[model samples]
Target: MKRLLLFILLSVFCLSLPLSAKAEGLRFGVPPWPGVTVKSEVVCQILEAMGYKTSQLEIGPPIIYKGLTTDDVDAFLAGWIPQQNEMFLPLKEKKAIDVVAINVDEAGTSLCVPTYVWEAGVRSIADLAAHAEKFDSTIYSIEIGSGMQVSTEDMIANNVAGLGGWNQISSTTPVMLSAVQERIRGKKWVVFHGWQPHWMNFQLDMKYLEGVPGTEKLVSNSVVYTVVSNDFAKRYPQPYAFLKKFYVSGAVQSEWINDFGFKKIAPEKVASDWIVANLDTVGEWLEGVTAADGSAGIDAVRSRFAN
Candidate 1:
């Protein structure tokens, strides 16, 4: 009778623990960007090493913002600010989300044209005016609501790029890339939004046009950050701290983006490979960061990964 009572007590105690205590699954949100997706996977793998199960909730820009506000999502690794300033400000004002840390600052979105366009002297925003006919009087952009579109519209509205009359066409990134590829194949003139640390840069020999005198030219240092829900830190302070302390260098992220973008390697494989080789770097992220259950950080990660 005593043995049975002890067994029953042990079972009851185990049942009382939170499911997260039994299975540390962290839900991370990812947008369609390759770098963001890849980095999130890398972080998730690291968390998994600490006995946490990580799941990605893929969402568009608007949905991601909504998820954070509703606490339907835990975190997003790709929060590009300043560019995303308009979107984040309202949420911030409402105290719906928290900016965790600046992850990679070596990236930017800018207007770029083919090398041929540069060769033909279309070197600046002002240069586009002369070749408006060649560009079909249209500015190719990614998604309709993306920051690039917003910025492009602003430029057109303000008549900063001599593109005041140009039409902005919205489409998915892949579609825009395909259009670019078509133009590249025929060596035709095209002007579109571009960014660095992306596969497109590696895949194509392109040039970012210098901004017109009064307009802001997109350049590097447009830092991408990590964002979490306002309730995240409060509910899971330990994991939140780990995320806050986490930092992935520019070179590291660029390399991963290059590999995934150009080599066409699977994201999971890239993530797994990166995690295994960069244990030391990842160790730094775990510094002073404990597991969700309050175990030794390094030990928990090591045991989890090594197993």
Candidate 2:
């Protein structure tokens, strides 16, 4: 009788273990940028629909690549090219991570001014120095360690576009955007780091400044990729295949950001609504993939959207 009780106790202990312990799921690392946040949400929601458990870690770029290298995170969807080339190149050389797919193409980053400011004859980086006093000899940019900040520093050091004495105001994204909005309202001259796949492109009447001879690379077009750990694909073939097939246009991503960032909607709801409206896109992403329960991935995702 005691032996029978011991067997039943052991069975209960095994049953009490968490589902995650039994089935390892994907862990996605997301930066603070809205576009990346929404992209991560869309992928996580789709994975959940396909019966795979997923989680997102809010990490910054400097540490995210390291996280991927150390296998602390499984994947990231905001690997912006050329702009992030410095951080990604070494990892690529070492085969530490894989560029699984180009999640967003035709994306670019540059200094942008309000349409009125552009109309005021400050349409290029070279034009900035001429009106230095008007712009307070300062350019607004996000956090100190960002690539934009680094490029701005180089521009100052090299006197590129005659901006040798110009200063860069470093702050968070929301603070920078708020400052831009205030300056726009006052018809003031302001230049700040701007990128596609963000609501600011739609919310503000802005134009990217033309790159000058020495500063052109700072404003070049960039492709955002989905990057995964080296062993992620081999360990989880279905999720890897689904991610490989995933793609979203810059316009579509901007809409998602506008909804989540400006309209105050939840990320999961935005992702779900997008999936419902664009089932064909989701179907394509899930082609040749199956759910955790071995059911058709497209069908599972479609059924979730239907309900």
Candidate 3:
């Protein structure tokens, strides 16, 4: 009878422990871009409210994907398709990672010039070379080793848009934008890498150039995806399921990015404010999902962020 009583006590003690005690905390990779930063925070905040411990690592794209493959990072929310296709395809082929969901769509990157430049007879990629003197034969881009930078290089090497001797300036996003702002103020001609779901679209008076003939591939629209290491779903099914339901439209994502990128709000504050304002939408992401302790996920989030 003593043995039976001790077994019962042990079982009760085991059941009393929180589920998170037995589960590994999630590690999310956040790229430098504002949109992805905001998205990562939104996911992390919701998971935290669901009783899961989480951490955000500020890693760039190449490292993020490699980390996902090696299980160093559990997930990344900024896998921009087509633009990132070259980076994601091999790992996907090896079954090293899984794209959980398309978080944002109708997104894209391309060479863009200020509206004044556009209005001044520079409406297409083909027009850039004609005004090369005004643009100083330069195209500004963010970071070395980015897909956009590579594409810009290809354009220069291949002499696309007659840019045979052109130069692509490499810099961070903030520096590139600051240059754009300066150019806009001076009403000077400037061409730079541009994409949606970014504050630049709203803040700058610019237009994406029409693709040059035979170079259409460089200006294609892209879809941003949430990606996870292959083992993530099996290891953390609740958070995985919640992540799969996550979806943010291009327009809405741009708004979140603008709040963080332009308004200079903290990413967590931007996420929380969006969550508080869009409870109905947040509920959709939590549908059929549960907290780490098997409680209703939506209820936990609502209670935690009720203010």
Candidate 4:
């Protein structure tokens, strides 16, 4: 009968809706950063323990923001303030995404120099101009069109802190770090972009600059937040609840970076090992959270990782 046919078609249509809309699983936008790599992995493992399936879209920040707006990605764990505000703020104003939580504490990104350079009176942005010859009037940064690159270019183009006419070198993270490392080996004066909760902070003996005229945006973003799509909560409240509870300290993130970035350990293994080592924090994150199967979130996680 026609009525039967209509019912079946409607059922199929409902079933074909996005699994995320039904809160079946979650998609995470993962940018190519070491701290986020392990951080996302740890969250994925915790969610898996709660019986939820998870996927990661390995992409850049711009694309990730686009995906979030389009409902293609449900969550992003690496929304750095000020640096990402160019792309994030507009969406936030439009209510396209929600800045959920500040996952990492004591976090920041800014230009820094070798300890020797800092010891030689190059402690602040103003001092860099005095020793322009030592640094060759060059500022090193990472990635073309990246947030840090954009900010550095602004500093030079607008002549902030006497940076006008200073050459800005931009490249991939690894390449830029290699050049910085080479300069450090020779103890040559070099200034490069750096951030906390990253291996570079530990590996390199350097100092984060302060007292820059136009560095309020750069130096003030000392914490990173979790960003989720607008519908992420209403559509997937279960996962959203767990995500809201997620938080990590700067020291913990740096340890994760060391294992995943410097030691080259697989992020999955690193996440699992950290979970096993820090059940107390895991329990804290699971407070008032529920698993996919409707069980207590903390209990589910503990049971899964009991081994």
Q: Estimate each model's TM-score.
A: 0.85, 0.88, 0.89, 0.87
Pick by TM-score: 3 or 4, better one: 3
- lDDT string for model 1 (1-307, tens) is 5633443343333223222322235677666577887999888877776766677875556667777787567788877766777777798887778888988878777788999889989888788878899998877776655567677888888877577888876555655677778888998889888886687877888998876664563433487888898888888776787888777767777778778866879889898888777778778888887776778677776775554
10 residues in a row with least lDDT, candidate 3: 14-23
Q: Per-candidate RMSD vs. true structure?
A: 13.3, 12.5, 14.1, 11.8
lDDT of 3 by residue, 126-176 (tens): 999989899989898765545676677877898887998998776557666
Q: What is the lDDT of residue 54 in candidate 2?
A: 86
* Residue 292 in candidate 4, Cα distance off native in Å: 1.7
User: Against the unseen true structure, what C-alpha lDDT does each candidate score?
Assistant: 0.74, 0.82, 0.82, 0.81
Please list the residue runs of candidate 4 whose C-alpha ends up more than 4 Å from where it truly belongs after superposition.
1-25
Residue by residue across 131-183, what tens digits does model 2's lDDT show?
A: 99999898887655456666777888999989998887765566678778988
For candidate 3, report its TM-score. Answer: 0.89
- TM for candidate 4 is 0.87
At residue 194, candidate 4 shows an lDDT of: 90
lDDT of 3: 0.82
Tell me the spans in candidate 3 whose CA falls farther than 4 Å from its real position. Answer: 1-24
